[model samples]
Target: MSRTTLTLGPLLYNWPAADWRDFYARIADEAPVDTVCIGEVVCSKRQPFYADVIPETIERLERAGKTVILSTLALPTLDRELKYCGSLAREASQMIEVNDISTIPALAKRPHAIGPLINVYNEAAAAFLIAGGAARIALPPELPLKSISAIVAAARNAVIEVWAFGRIPLAISARCYHARLHGRTKDSCQFVCEQDLDGLDVETLDGERFLAVNGVQTLSYSYCNLIFEARQLESLGVSALRLSPHTCDMVAVSQIFRDVLDGIREPSHAMRAMRTICSDAAFSNGFVHGTNGALYVLE
Candidate 1:
């Protein structure tokens, strides 16, 4: 019953600025997570809304004895975006998660963390990042467990983190899906994505629920739940479980994970409690089992 650190990832949804601020404020004061990732990782357009509140949030989280890591945009296109990413790397913060490749050179000489968005499927890639000053690496959610184990062994000295919860961020594109859903182009999107807090659901041609469209990002319809896999991951020597921000009771979620990690509660009990909190969304551990990313394989 070894303890695994819990990290609160940056929010991926388009909630109101006040809601965003309030969520982190509560996290700083109450959540049991060891680290809290701040800043925008999705569309850059949403950055301005909460940008003013980030510094204060960082200060508060740090004062609460929680390690704060600033996350960069997953996709960088415009010159302004690149500049902003560079500024994030250069900031006095010791830890920053680089989601895009462009941030590598900008943060190469400095010490920083790497996010799951940057592919690290093999040991060589892990070594490369570790050599480039990455103290920790959050493996991409799409990677199978075998690859994760291999990377973890390779990164013996570096901290290894996994996406433990939330809707999996499957892909990103220059086009805004919200605009496409509304029959408008990206250039004239008019910030339509702000309407959906948890992202707009995208269905298949046969009317089956498939994925979610959040501006430039594509996410899974099912939330990724790894509560049952906590023991397996701990046995593998994983350092942390990254819980992506969602509009749920995160403090309760963290408590459940803490209980599971502390051996005070069994995985089955944790899963049952999660069901009560996660609403109607299905949970999947398929990617970890090397199967379809959406399949829920109960052990």
Candidate 2:
């Protein structure tokens, strides 16, 4: 079987500039991913801290032979945020990953990618975006194999990518939960979200782990793991698998997925290796299995 492309997704958390630079520097030197998505996708307030380093990182990744895709904010409410998205859209030199429809008009007729945040639930939606010059569509993480196969079969012109690993971003709201939690207004948030690099874990009243909060975004508490479903996704015409960035050893994570795509590593063994790599993260495939998003379904 031909190898499925492994794309390293943009960093969703707010890491210190030094940490972020070192992380990508390591990725450039070692990771086996074909594409690497950069830019601040969660909160616009966090972008400026790392904006100066982006050009250098992109150059490094390009030198490393990785396709660097720039990702827009999933919820760009502010005028400046929208302008940033537009600026990214106008970058003819690189591919833009549109996370919101607000960025669509600016990218009209240009070949761009549709991030998972935009709801492309059915075949019609997939076809519509492809018609508008979407070269690739990364399906929402909650989709099942049935829906995935359906869209992939219908949208032959676009590369259908799936979220293969990392915390599934559930939703984004205008209200900043991180700011609210800190008892500060959104405007005076003081970048309090910087405290939790992996996002603040939200636990239920009953002491069970619930979701995670990152400013305006809500994410799954358990990291989405589809190591076993990789081959099935490949067989169904899925062209790429996205691995979301985390504080974990992503280079090793990318290698594991690449090994599976290359038939050099068995899924069972890959899962075992992942357990060692992401020792603190709880694994979940429930969304893909058509069950509760919080549950981990054993294969």
Candidate 3:
């Protein structure tokens, strides 16, 4: 069997333009990831700040022998948002990842890929998309191993990717929680979400750490760590593993995962190295085991 491909998912945060550019520049030069997905998937408001920077970033990544993919918005509601996605699908040279069902029409049966934000839960759904010309489908992060294995078994024509790392994106809302937290409406509030690099952590009234808030996106506080499950996922015929971007030392993070996937380092040793790389990250693998998403199951 071939080695599983490692893909760096799009940056979901709103960092300064320089920071964003520098981050990708470094990834292009140093990260071991085989694929890199860029473009704003979180908020349209954040796009303008780094809009002009994307082309250059893509050029740099492609020059580095990486397959680059442009991702559409996960939630495109407004007419302008819809129009922008339509245009991107019709014009972009690189392969695009469709994050919303609305963008499907724009795809025009073109050879495109599917993002995790789309609700593809079964083999039939995966087959329907592959027949529609989808080259690959990044399965939703919340799926269990059984569902994933079944989908992989049936969709032999398309590459099936698993969400292997980063905080699981739980839900997205029409309302901007970041603006509301700062006493401003979605329209009036400044881009306050940019302040939180990863996301704003939420806790219960009793002080238990809960979820995270990023503008309209609610995510898990615990970062999803699948280092222990990489080999198993590959065994189940998973074609690729996606590692979402975080503000932490991601190049080191990718290298560690690459070593484990390549069988150069044991998962336990890599887990220890990961602690030093992302000390604040609370590792979780329960979702793969069909348990609480926040819990880490070693078996």
Best by TM-score: 3
Candidates 1 and 3: which is better by TM-score? Answer: 3
| Residue 47 in model 2: lDDT | 85
Q: What is the per-residue lDDT of model 2 for residues 91-148, given as tens digits with 9 covering 90 to 100?
A: 6489999999999999977999999999999999999999999998999998988999
Determine which window of 10 residues in candidate 1 has minimal summed lDDT. 87-96
Measured against the true structure, the TM-scores of the candidates, in listed sequence, are 0.97, 0.98, 0.99
- Residue pairs in clash, model 3: none
Candidate 2 stretches with Cα past 4 Å from truth are: none
Give the alpha carbon lDDT tens digit for every residue of 99-145 in model 3.
99988888899999899999999999999999998999999988999
**What ranking emerges by TM-score with the best candidate at the front?**
3, 2, 1
- What is residue 280's positional error in candidate 3, in angstroms? 0.6
Clashes of each: 0, 0, 0
Where does model 1 exceed 4 Å of error? none
Among these predictions, the greatest lDDT belongs to 3
lDDT of 1 by residue, 70-132 (tens): 899999899999999998788655588899989888775677888989998888999998998
| CA shift of 214, model 1, Å | 0.9
